[model samples]
Target: MPLWCHASPAAAGAAHSEPALPLAGGNARVSPEVSAEQDEEGEGDGRRWSSLVPELLADILRRVDADAEKWPKRRDVAVCACVCRRWREVTIALVRPPLHCGRVTLLSSLKQPGPRDAPLQCFIKRNKKKSTFHLYLSLTQALIDEGKFLLAAHRNKCGFHMEYIISIRGDLSHGSHVGKIKSNFTRTKFTICDLQPQYEGSKVPSSSCRPRLASKQIKPLASTGNVETGKVSYEYNLLKSRGPRRIRCSIRCPIEEDTEIDPRKAKKPSTPGSLVLYNKLPQWHEHLQCWCLNFHGRVMVASVKNFQLIAPAGAGGPWGIQDDDAVILQFGKIEDDVFTMDYRQPLSAFQAFAICLSSFGSKLVCE
Candidate 1:
C-alpha cells in the first residue's frame, strides 16, 4: 500500500486541503470537508483511475509537476504520486532529484547532494530550553521564517564531549537518526558519523563504532556499525587574536564513476574521496570593532557564529564547480533563535547541518 493511504486522518486532511490542480486562471482551493468527501468518492472509483494509459498519465503528471514548482503547491506532486501505483511510477519518472532541480520536494531529497549551480537556501530554528535545533527549507524568501521542515537535532552533553544527534524526525529518536556530530572536551575538534555507510563497498570504521556501543539508545542501531564520514576542526588561535572563528571540514564523498557496467561482474566501488572546505575570511569593521561577511542581507545580526564556507581554488573536482570562489556553504545568525544556512553541491543537507551544529558551543581558544 502507498504510505499516504496509511497516514492518520489529520495528515490526510491536511494534504487534501492543498490545491492539487491548477485552474484555467488560478488555483482552485478546496475546503478540508469538501476534500474529504472527494477523497471518499475517488477511493470508491479507484479502479477507473488506475486504468489510465501510461503515456497520458505521464503527460498529466508532467504538467502538474511543472505547475506546482514550490512547496505547499509542490506537495501536489506528492499527492499525485500517492493516488495509485501507475501514478506513482509516472510521478517518480517526472520528478528530478535535488542535485538537478535544486528543490527538495520529498523526504528522500534530504539525503541527496544539493544543486551544482546554486545553493539551496534553508534555515535553522533553535530551542534553547530544549537544546534542540530544527532545519527547514526556506519556502518563500531568504530570511523568511516560513519553511518546509527537513531534519532536526538534539544536543546532549555526554561526559567530556558534546553530542548532537541528527535525525529525520523531530523527536530525535534512535530509529529516525541518520547520523551524529561529536565534539571534544574543549569543543574545538569534532567528528561526524553516519549510521550507515554512505558509499558503495565502504565499511563502518571500527573506531567510530566504540562510542555508540556504550550507549543504550544507540547500541542496537549501531549493531551494523557507524562510519566516520567527516571531521570538523576549529583552527586554534595560539596568539588569541580577537577575530572570528576559523574552521575547516574534511568530508568523505563518493567519487564519480561510470554506471553502465553489469552488476553481476562489477567489482567493489572505489573508496570515497575527501572534499575540503574552509571558512571564508571576514573583514574587520573599524567602527563596529567586529568582523563582518557580506551575507547580502540574509543575515541581520552580528555574531561570531556567522561564517561562509568556500572551496579552495582547484579543490572543486568533487563538488563539480567551475567557480572556485563560490560559497559552497554559508551559515549565519538572523535572530537569537533563528539562523540561515545555504549550501550547494558536494554537500548533502546532512553534511551541511552537521557542520553548522559544530558552531553552536563556545570555542574560547578560537574566538
Candidate 2:
C-alpha cells in the first residue's frame, strides 16, 4: 500500500494544498482564506494583531516549537507559519535547519543539508513493475514498515539515455516534479539537476508554476528551471573482479561551518561547495565467500547495491571530518523490494535518494 494512503484525510489535503516551503529563492504561498480575510478586514485588524508584543509572541512560539518536534506534530510549526507574516517569521526563526535539529519540519528541509551528528534515517520502496521509487522518512528509531512520505521518482527511458523524474506527488506528474536524474548512454554516469535554481534572487517565471491540483490551488516550487547540483559515476571493472562495486559522487550544496555551536549562532557559507563521496571498500568474508560491509544489522541482505559512502581525506571541507572513518551515507538492502538509506551533513534527502537510484538497473559496462 502507498504511504500517502496511510495519511489522514486532513494531512493528505494539507500536503496537496500547501505551497512549497521557501527555499532557493521561492516564496511561500499565502492560504486563500488568510488572503481573503486580510483583504476584507483591511490593515486595521492586521495591525492590531501585529501589535502583539514581539517578546510575548516569541515566547509562545518557542513553547509551541519545543512541544512539536516531530512530524504529524511537526505540522504545527508549519501551521504557525501560515497564520500570519509575524507568525511565519517567528516560526522560521525558531525552527532549525535539518543540519542542526535532525528533523525535517518543513518542505524546505528536503533541500537543506542533513544532520551532522547522525545520518537521517530513511527507506526506499521500489515498484519494479512500474519502474517507480518512493522515498520515506522512517518514523521510528528502527526500520519497520510505516513512514512519512518524502519524495517519489519514476524511471523513463528515452532512447539510449534514462531519466528519473522526482516529485513530491506519488503519481510523479510533471507539474509536481522537483528535480530529475539523467544518465549517459552506457548508464555508467548520471547527472542530478534541481528544477529550482540554487542561488537566492533568481526568479521562476510565472509560466513554470503549473499546479498538479489546479482546483485545490497546489503550486509547488519545484516547477522552476533546472540547475545541475551533483553527479554520480561508477568505476568500471573491466576484469570483472570478485570485489564489490565501486562508485563516486560529487555534490554541490551548502556546508555547515560549525555544528558544535548553536545552529542559530553558527555561520554558514553562502556558496555551495563540492562534496565528494566514495564507497567504502568491503572485506571478503572467506567463510561466506562474499564481500561485506557492516550495516550495524540494519541491512540483512548482501547485494552489489549495498554501499557505505565516506568522505575522502581532505574532501570534508566544512563538514569537519578529520578522517575518512565516518560513514556519510549508507544504503543497503533490507528486503527484496525495500532498502535502507541513511545520509548526513552536505547531502540532502533528494541528493541521497538520487544516488541510491543510480544503484538500480544493470550496469553492464561497469560490472
Candidate 3:
C-alpha cells in the first residue's frame, strides 16, 4: 500500500522522514545518472541496443525496476528502458504510441493551479514500485493556455467542443507515490437534462454503451433532435487497474433560476397531472429549481459526503417545448472540489422521470 493508505504525502512529509538511498541492481554498474538527480537531469550514456545481448537487456530492465524501488514492475512498460541499453530501445518502441501522457495541452482548457490528482489517480501513483516512471509534465496548462475557442462560449454552436486540462504531478517526497499515478483522459461524461440541449443530445455514438436511458418516459438523448446538443452523458469503465480500493464520485448541477420545460405535448408525467386538456396548454410546464455544487479536492469542513437525485428522469423530451420551459440542477461547494449536491422543485402535478445520475459509473454495480 502506497502512503495514501491513510495519510497524505504532505502529512507524511511533515513527519520528518529521511529521503531514500539509491540501490541499483545487476552487474552493469549503476548508471552515473543514479547519483546525478534521482530522476532529474542525469548523465545518461545513449548507448545502442545492438551492442548488448537479449538476456542482458532483460536484466537491465530488472535493474531499472529495482533501482526505482517505487514503480510497479507489472504495468509500466516504460521503466524497462531504464534497465539497460538494449532494453531501453525496446521499451521506447512499446511506449512511444502514448509516449505522451498527462494533461490535455489545449489553450481553451484550464486546470486548478494545484495538484490534479483524483483519489484513484492518487492511489495508482503511490502504489507503483518502479523508478524512471512517467510524470504528468510536458502537458501542463502552460503548454496550451494560448488558443481561443469561440465555440466554448456559445450554447448553440455547430461544433461540439469543451476545453479541459488533465495534468499529473507526483509527491516527490515519496517515490512510491509517484509510481502509483498514471495519465488520464481528456473528456468526462456529463448530462443535465433540461440544462443544455447540446448536453442532453450530445451523444458520441458509442455501441458499447448499454442503453441506460430512462426508456419509460424519455428516449436516448441521442435519437431526438438533441443531436449535437450540449447534453453529454459519460459512461465510465471503472477498472481494477486504476487506483484506490474505492473511488468517491461527485456531481453538482446548479439551477440559478426558476426554469420550466414545457414539452408542447409531453406524455403523462410521474407527477399527477391536472393540466387542462382542451383550453389549457396541451403541454404542461414543469417548474423546477436546483442548486449545483462542484468540488475540486478533499473535504476539510462539515459538508455532504454524497448526493442522490430524487425521482430522476427515465424517458423524456424532444417534445413540444415552449420558450419559458427549462430545468436547472445547481451544484454546491464548487471551490472546495467536494462537488456536493442541492436541488428544489415545484409540487406541480406533472409527469416526467426523475433524474438519475451519480458519481458511480454507469457500469459500476449493474443490476
In terms of lDDT, the best-performing candidate is 2
* Per-residue alpha-carbon lDDT of candidate 1 for residues 177-286, written as tens digits (9 for 90 to 100): 77899999889999999876234454444655444534444333244446888999998885768466889999886556322122222366534789888999998789
C-alpha lDDT of all candidate models, in order:
0.74, 0.75, 0.24
lDDT at residue 209 of model 1 (Cα atoms): 46
Off by over 4 Å in 1: 1-50, 84-86, 197-225, 255-272
Could you give the candidate ranking by TM-score, starting with the highest?
Answer: 2, 1, 3
Q: Alpha carbon lDDT of residue 137, candidate 2?
A: 90
Using all chains and alpha carbons, the TM-scores for the candidates as numbered come to 0.77, 0.79, 0.24
Task: Tell me the alpha-carbon RMSD of every candidate.
Answer: 6.8, 7.9, 22.9
Q: Which candidate, 1 or 3, would have the higher lDDT against the true structure? A: 1
lDDT comparison, 1 vs 2, better candidate? 2
lDDT of 2 by residue, 1-367 (tens): 0012223446433433444222212243322224545546664344433455788667666776787767667655566565457766676677777888998776667777888788889999999999999998988887756888889999999998899998877887656678999999999899999886333454545644543445564333333577899999998886787466889999997753443222334466456889888999999899988787789987978788899999988888576666678898899998899999999888889899999999998888776
- Tens-digit per-residue lDDT, 1-367, candidate 3: 1001212344323222222212244333323223335234422223322334666555554554434322232122332333344553544332211002211111111110111121111100111232211111111122222221111110111233222111122223311110111111322333322211223545544544433444533334423222111122333435533321122222221112111112222243223212111000112234523222222332123222222222223211211112122222222222232232222222110000111122222233211
- Return the TM-score for candidate 1, rounded to 2 decimals: 0.77
